[model samples]
Target: MKFITLSNGVKMPILGYGTFTMSNDETERCVTEAIQVGYRLIDTAQAYRNEEGVGNAIVKCGVSREELFITTKIWVENAGYEKAKRSLEESLKKLQTEYIDLVLIHQAFNDYYGTWKALEEAYKSGKVRAIGVSNFYPDRFMDLVTFSEINPMINQLETHVFQQHKNDKKFLEKYGTKLEAWAPFARGSHGIFENEVLMQIAKQHNKTIGQVALRFLIQNGIIAIPKSVHKNRMEENLNIFDFSLSNENIKKIEELDLGENVFMDHENAEDIERFFKMFKIGNK
Candidate 1:
């Protein structure tokens, strides 16, 4: 398991187990299995509503708290300083941890600056070891980095073979902020699994297209979290350490870049409206 040291000097795994849409029972079971299969970093979010399940897995996994790197997000509904802080406290209760390894402002919506301030305070209080943002496009990413007392240590993006996020990587490099990919597979869309370039590379190394895809990101110094409900896929995702992709093949995979998002777009008006509605309901 390779690690990348954030600007703040904390080491984060280059790969992690993502628990985005897992149910309570699924989060608990898959997280347990992930740990047993040697995954130390578990990603969850308050919006996922499975923090309790993740917490349950942490308690029951029989792994010491220190060995695990737990990350969660402050949902859009929990924006603002007080709401964000209180929500993290609730997350702590749900996650069964005294301190989270990383806590990200889940979206750029609402009072994220204020939400970031809460994260900053939490960092000072030793309640969180690292702070970051997710789905923060370049404009918002730079805005937060410029005004914050402590720079964001990570920015999780919608990255995959098609949306390589090259420009974002260069921008993050300027601030010493790290990059993490949320959907490293493009969710199997855009013919990612069936691509000729990727297929050829996978054949050369006797690896699956998924493994080749993950190796490409990890090699490019990007941290990625690929979620899977199956134990076999979980293990396969973890098995990319032994082989290295050639620069020639890396260049081939780079050709797959389309510079577009495969999933939700933050700039979409409907998406923005959805965020507002989701939070408005939460306030009630």
Candidate 2:
């Protein structure tokens, strides 16, 4: 596995396993298999409600706590200095660890500034090695970095071939924050798996389209956490380090970028309303 050093000098695996929308039982089972398949970074969230499952897998995976990188997020409902701090404690207990490798504010909603303060405190207290935010767009991201005491070490977004987030990447560069892709596959949207460009590249490298997609992101210095319930797919996702994509091949794939988010648009008010409804935080 490859590693990237965050602004704070913490080395993080370039690839990781994300457990979103997973039940506790599914998270435990899949996380166990993912670890067996050689994944060291495990991302969970308070919204996912499966940190306990991740904890179970941690104890069961037979890997030492020091060797694994565990990440969890503060949900919108837990978005305050007190609430977020309390949530972190709960997450640490659920993850069965004294210190988390990373902790991110799950979204830009609620009192994220307060949540960030909580994370900052957690970082100073040695409870978390790194702190970041998820789903924050450029404007909001810049605002936070400008005002915050500590710049974010990372920002997780819905990055994929279709929505490459090139502008965001460049913007984050100014702050020395690494860009991470949450839905690195775009959840298989936009015919990503069957795209001729990715297909051709995969054929050239004797790899799968998913592997090529992830390789593209990782090659561009973006951290990717692709999730799969199947062990074979999990293994396939991790087997992206063997070959390299040529510059010409990268250009072909780069043309595949539509340069806009194919998923939820965080900048759109209508989309934000829908998101709130979906997450049942409309009243928040």
Candidate 3:
């Protein structure tokens, strides 16, 4: 379990278990298994609607609160100062913790500026250890960083071998912000599991394609949260810390970058509107 020190000097695990599409029951079981497998960080969100399960797993795992890094986000619907603050308190109750390590705005849309004000206040009050934003592009990210009282400690985006986010990483580095990857495996799209280059590299290291994909991101200094319901897959994702990829192998993986998003493109206005519409109906 390697750690990445944030701009505020908080140490976060380089790898974490993400609860994206997992059901509440599955999240509880898998999070418990992940903690048993030596995972100290767990990522969840208000939209995930499984924070209670994560909190239950933490309590049942018997790991001290200090040894764990728990993160949750404020959904777009809760993106105002009052709502965000209330939401954070609700999250704390659901998580069964007094304080949170990190709390992020789930998306850049809606009233994110107001949401950020609440987060800034929470950080100052010692309720949240660190504050950040997820799914923010460079333009919106810069706007927040320049205008806010506290610079964002992290900006999590969709990143993987295919969507490498080279330009975004450079921009984030300028503000002393760390980059976290949401879909580290690109959700196994575009035949990622069958990529010849990655498979060949896995053979050389005697590892699986998934392991190779995770290692590639970690080697590039990106924080990744890979999700899996299976305990065996959870263990496999955690086994990436033992090996190193050579410069040649790293270059080969770089060539695998397609420079485009494999999933939803937030840049499109229609896509953005459609996303918000789903949030309105609570479909996401």
Estimate TM-scores for all models: 0.96, 0.98, 0.97
Best-to-worst ranking by lDDT:
2, 1, 3
Instruction: Locate the minimum summed-lDDT window of 10 residues in model 3.
Output: 275-284
lDDT of 3 by residue, 1-284 (tens): 89999999999999999999887888899899999988899999999999999999998998899999999999988888999999999999999999999999988877889999999999999999999999998789988988999989998998999989888898898898889999999998989899999999999999999999999988888999999888899999999988989999999999998988766787888877777776673445
Of 1 and 3, the candidate ranking higher by TM-score:
3
For model 3, what is the error of residue 182's alpha carbon versus the real structure, in angstroms, after optimal superposition? 0.6
Give lDDT: candidate 2, residue 83: 92
List candidate 1 segments past 4 Å from native.
274-284
Q: Candidate 1's residue-wise lDDT over 1-284, tens digit each?
A: 99999998999999999998899999999999999998999999998999999999999999999989999999887899999989999999999889999999998878998899999999999999999999999889888888989889999998999999998899898898899998999888988889889999999999999999999999999999999999999999999999999888988889889988866777788876675675564453
Q: Residue 14: error of model 1 in Å?
A: 0.6
Candidate 1's displacement at residue 265, Å, is 2.3
How well does candidate 2 score on lDDT at residue 139? 78
Least accurate stretch of 10 residues (summed lDDT) in model 2? 275-284
lDDT of 1 at 181: 93
Predicted model with the maximum TM-score:
2
Error of 2 at 71 (Å): 0.9
Ranked candidates, highest TM-score first:
2, 3, 1
Against the reference, the lDDT scores of all candidates come to 0.92, 0.92, 0.91
Summed backbone clashes in each candidate are 0, 0, 0
